[model samples]
Target chain A: MDPSRLTIAQASAAIAQGSLAPLSLVDSYLERIASLDGELHSYVLVLAEEARERARALAAEPSRGPLHGIPLSLKDIYWTRGRRTTAGSRLCLDFVPAEDAETWRRLEAAGAILLGKNETHEFAIGGPDFTLPFPPARNPWNTAHYPAGSSSGSAVAVAAGLTAGALGSDTGGSIRGPAAFNGIAGLKPTYGRVSRRGVFPLSYTLDHCGPLTRTVEDCALLLQAIAGHDPLDPASADRPVPDYRKALERRLDGMAIGVIRHFHEADAVAGFGPENAPNPAYCAAFEEACRTLEKAGARLVDLRLSPLLDYADANRLIMLAEAFALHETDFQERPQGFGRYAFARIGLGAFFSAADYVEALRARRELCREFREATEGVDAVVSANATAPAPKIDTVPLWGVFERASYTAPYNLLGAPALSLPIGFEDGLPLAFQIAGKPFAESSVFKVGYAFEQATPFHRERPPIAASLPGRT
Target chain B: MAEPIPPDRFTVLVERAGLKLTPEEFEELREGSRFVERMKESVRRSGPREARLRGVTRPREKTAEPAHIFIAGKD
Candidate 1:
């Protein structure tokens, strides 16, 4: 049977039960990628032979874990041996890592088949830019719309049914932003839950690695396999790995959810509210989805944070400071090699002082505390996954970074777990909502999310783009 | 308590941090730092000296309890 939309956990169970052949499953994805990628441009490279070879080996072995024999995409920012990680910029177009990122080693051990490397915003900061060497990956639902970034390709690939799911890193909404507009589920786990040893750093202190999937259980399964203590990653959490997959089976009978309401009323992705925002219909859809989620099982409390613009400003500053630190020498030595957005944003890091960087870190810690206290009695928090629907691809401006704050960055400041899940759609555009939990409390967030998803039909709806693929549906 | 990074030191900090910005990038950073400074105040004023901001977190250890961990069909 074809494996286009199966969550990793679902397919793993099917393969283990002889319901789906692993080799055949891999072939379905390979064919889908070949046929659809020409238009979506979601992948940085297509590793057909390598993936097939691995798939053949997995076919012989008993499925090892939840993601066994499942096809999964890796973001370009992730370092993989023998694969080019361009980070959506020409500067790293040919660079390959000799060692797998720690997460890669874990995913392989879990037995997930490699689909290929997905595209990203340059260096996981600036993104969806057409000016880069490769065309920015477009949202699969509406090819003309934006697919948020720097988890751009991973989100689109999962949304468009190019692969079962993908691995993405989020520093400031890179994972959740793309997931929202692409109509997939993304989990930005607690700051240190997943190791960042091999993932390229945008901001060392703020960077987090997690999964983008079609469902919450899939995210739980992926997180189970990849999350644990890693000696190589200084920031890796050393806690015992809870049975995250099992947690999904638990009830959400008494969980409290707070609503981060400020962004929806006044903030827009491009700087205006529903009335002034480019897509009013999309905003209405987002509200209706929240109402439905509230009715399903979650208790929605009205909560407010500072303007997203303030959080966005601080986040951009910290990202610049740290990313510039990572690329300082390369930038000074070969400025021409970088994409325009990377050049502008990372280059801005040059303007930050040691005091400024430290100030940002201190502020980040404070915000994390404030957000944590706000979540004391609540199981998770809810908010718009995006201010509006994805903007038209070619029309996005270079300086659009400064225009507004993002809903995704507040959690980044607080080092909390923020997950984005599909809620509803209108005007051919998808709207999403975030379920955020306290620091290192991803399982609770997943439980709340999985319960809501189990009660709703949003994840059941596939984009029209998947119909163009062979045997996908 | 750590004093927030002053606005005037931004140029040297950016240069030291090793970014290559045009004149405009510098101005954006200057403007952006206004908000960053406010956030820094929040972190600097955290409750206690030993609040410990940097501890590694992990999942709870699994126990020997058997069938409760796995629900029928729910898995």
Candidate 2:
């Protein structure tokens, strides 16, 4: 067996059964990173010795659990005891924490190995800015295109198979965007499903900590490790942690899925001008994908809500105001510690009056209500994750994220669970669909996601783009 | 949004944000602000409710001895 191809469940079974040694497993990933990461530049820092030591400890313990000795990467925003989490900027280059983030602590307790801190958009709100100390993480599929942000490195690192799985935060589609672009599976659970105790805040209201893995099963395995209540996290929900791993087997049969055509319809009306509309090729593939799902015994229906741009705007204001409020002191003191993009964008919060933020929130409430009512009877809302295939990194318009109200942002506003799964392909580039469930319906989303992944081969194709050498997407 | 934010105001906000925008960079930002403004306008219409930044919440049923020491946030 190519040990590298093993999903989280398979690897966990192997390790627990004494068939896989932790040191050897950790060493394999390290070798891959050394051989492959030079081209990808997906990581911010690589902690080889630390990982080896943890793996050694797990191997010595005869009864380590399933996640025992798994090597995982941390998106740079998550604080670690000794590692500097730069969040793809120079501001926090010297910042180190005394404790691991709650997710890191839980994963460590379950015997997972920390591979290293990976790169990301600055402060979870910047970008694939080249001016940062590290280059923006290039997509493993096509090095020339973005892997997406702010969890850029987390997605690319996992997609390129540098690590078994990784932790990433999603405030406004960060986890799902990169996962979709990289053609991997990711779960952005309900806002409070996972604790954000030690992770840097983007918009405290919208931010969620979740996992990016190649398979939904892997995501399930990772969520089992990360989901829990934290008295420390003020927004943390004190709900009972369900058996997410077991929930993967739940059937998706008879589930109702809504296909949103509002933004797609409106964007088309605006005339995405040939280069930007859903590529005819992608649109056809998407229809075919829907047909396949319906034939497989799931109800597919047309679903639309208000224009996507409206939801995105609410998300932006909420995120900016909250983020700026978090950084008020820093903005005053060491303003230069942040990169130009991070400072300028987050700084807008300052210009925004408190009334502006409150007014935006009022709008968010209505949007959330509309989203809930629209999705009332549906188990999941199926929508295009991207309008088209990954575009070139340099071509990403400065306003790309803002200009189009994306299919992903509405769910963020409603604080629902969104799973981005690789559904099919367009040309050689990957294509994906967004499956959103009711708030805290992570299990439902994962169940359908796992079934779709099982039925498709999209996850099998690795990015031809190499880490050591860049290629155009 | 209003004759495109003036280059001089761009200079002020750029300095306010402590960013040193080259001529091209400044121009890009000025243009980008249109998108930003559009986004802001769109978000403002999200429908009225409460605060944009979510506030803290205490557990519904406090533990007999709740971890009295609330974790101090890192700004």
Candidate 3:
């Protein structure tokens, strides 16, 4: 099998048994990035020399673990010791941290090769704004379409086979948004499930770090290396890390799956404009996906919680307010350093008074409780990953997040484990849905997502860009 | 329809955010202000009827000491 085409499980088994050389594996991915990244723009930096050196070093030693010799990318927001960590903003473009992000440290300790850093929205709040120092990542499915971000490059990298997996931090749909648009697998582990120490904070409370990969099982592999208690991260949960990969083999039989359909319906939630509603193709695909799970012996039940806008409003208030607070000094000092979209969006955070923030937090608590109660009987909850397929890059309106409710934001609010993976295609673009579990229930989320992934043919499909590349597909 | 934040107040808020934008940048942000207004209004309309003095409870209890505290998830 082409090194780039091998799933993490396959490649890891090959490397563990010495059938595949780590150096050659790194070379294969580097070559793929060299060929496809010009159009994909998935990476801000390509540490080719360093990656080769790391792979050479790993191949010299006995296998360390499943991630040993695996090539992975980090979203630029993660602080890498002695490496430029630009949070996709010109500000701090030359900044290098003295210590590595906890996630980076874990991956490196597990013997994963760092291919480079993926691009992200400025400070992870900036949307796919083009005026940034680096070009925003384009959708691999359609180069002209936007790859939803701030995990933008991470998703594109995985979707285009530029890397085996990449790490993305989700505050408000950063990981899942890009995952859906790029037709890959992304996991936003429960907040505190993965440490955020050394990663740029958008909202300390809502931020989650996880992986974007070609398959759900690969996501579990990446998560295992990164998920654990971190004393350095105040938010890190002190909990036993479940064997996520082992959990993937569990069948969904007799499990109750909660379906959140109101989120995709027009009249069900106010402020969700018609354009923001899930398209007919996506709706049909999601229904079929539910039925697919049903055939797998999972019981599907209709579930409702608070309206989607309630979660959206609360999440936006807390995120922007915290983001504004973090960047206040920088914005006040170097306003010109930020892109227009980021400045406008983060600046709006100033309008949120302490009272507004307090109220939003209170509402968040209520919503979280509501979500817990609503899903008590179910093992996992599923919903449309994105309201619609990726729109053209030129058509993504600035501040569009406020005009529509995000199906993914509710999970962030509850700090639940959420995974987004390709379900099917709509109008030639990828369509996706999210499978989420209660806080700290990533194993359950992975089990459901892996079952669906194995039962479907969507993961087998590659982007048109990949088809055009020589020796690809 | 919810009313947009008034232009005068919006201008004050922009300065308060410590941003000094060019005329073009300021105008662009002025348009974005409508979206911000909607977001604030949404929160206002959806806020819980009663306020909690202590604010939302921390989803997890912090460790008494600087020790790792792990919350076990159900299988």
Winning candidate number (DockQ): 3
lDDT, candidate 1, A223-263, per-residue tens: 88888889778777789888887778434667677887657
Q: Considering DockQ, where higher is better, how would the candidates rank from best to worst? A: 3, 2, 1
TM for every model, in the order presented, reads 0.85, 0.88, 0.93
Model 2 per-residue lDDT at A163: 87
Tens digits of per-residue lDDT, candidate 2, A1-473, equal 44555677788888888897878777777877887888888888999998898888888886556688788999999999977876676877888888899999999888889999888999987876777898888887778877888898999988887889999999889999889889998878898889999998888789999999988888988898888888889878888877876766434678888888656645433422234467677677677767766765689888767666567677777787789888888877777677767866776665555656765666676676677888888887777778677778888755566554466777777888899988777656778888888888887788777767666688777776423222211
Q: In model 1, which regions exceed 4 Å deviation?
A: A249-251, A266-283, A468-473, B1-75
Which segments of candidate 2 are over 4 A away from where they belong? A267-276, A465-473, B1-3, B6-29, B44-75
The TM-score obtained for chain B by all candidates, in the order given, is: 0.49, 0.52, 0.51
Ranking of all predicted structures according to TM-score, beginning with the best and ending with the worst: 3, 2, 1
Query: Any residue pairs clashing in model 1, and if so which?
Result: A239-B58, A239-B59, A240-B59, A350-B14, A351-B14, A353-B13, A363-B39, A368-A414
Model 1, B35: alpha-carbon shift in Å?
Answer: 8.9
Residue A276 error for model 1, in Å? 7.0
DockQ of each: 0.11, 0.16, 0.23
Measured on C-alpha atoms, candidate 3 has an lDDT of: 0.84
lDDT of 2 by residue, B1-75 (tens): 223467776677667755554576567667666544555555544222122222222222222221112467731
Ranking by lDDT: 3, 2, 1
Worst 10 residues of 1 chain A by lDDT: A269-278
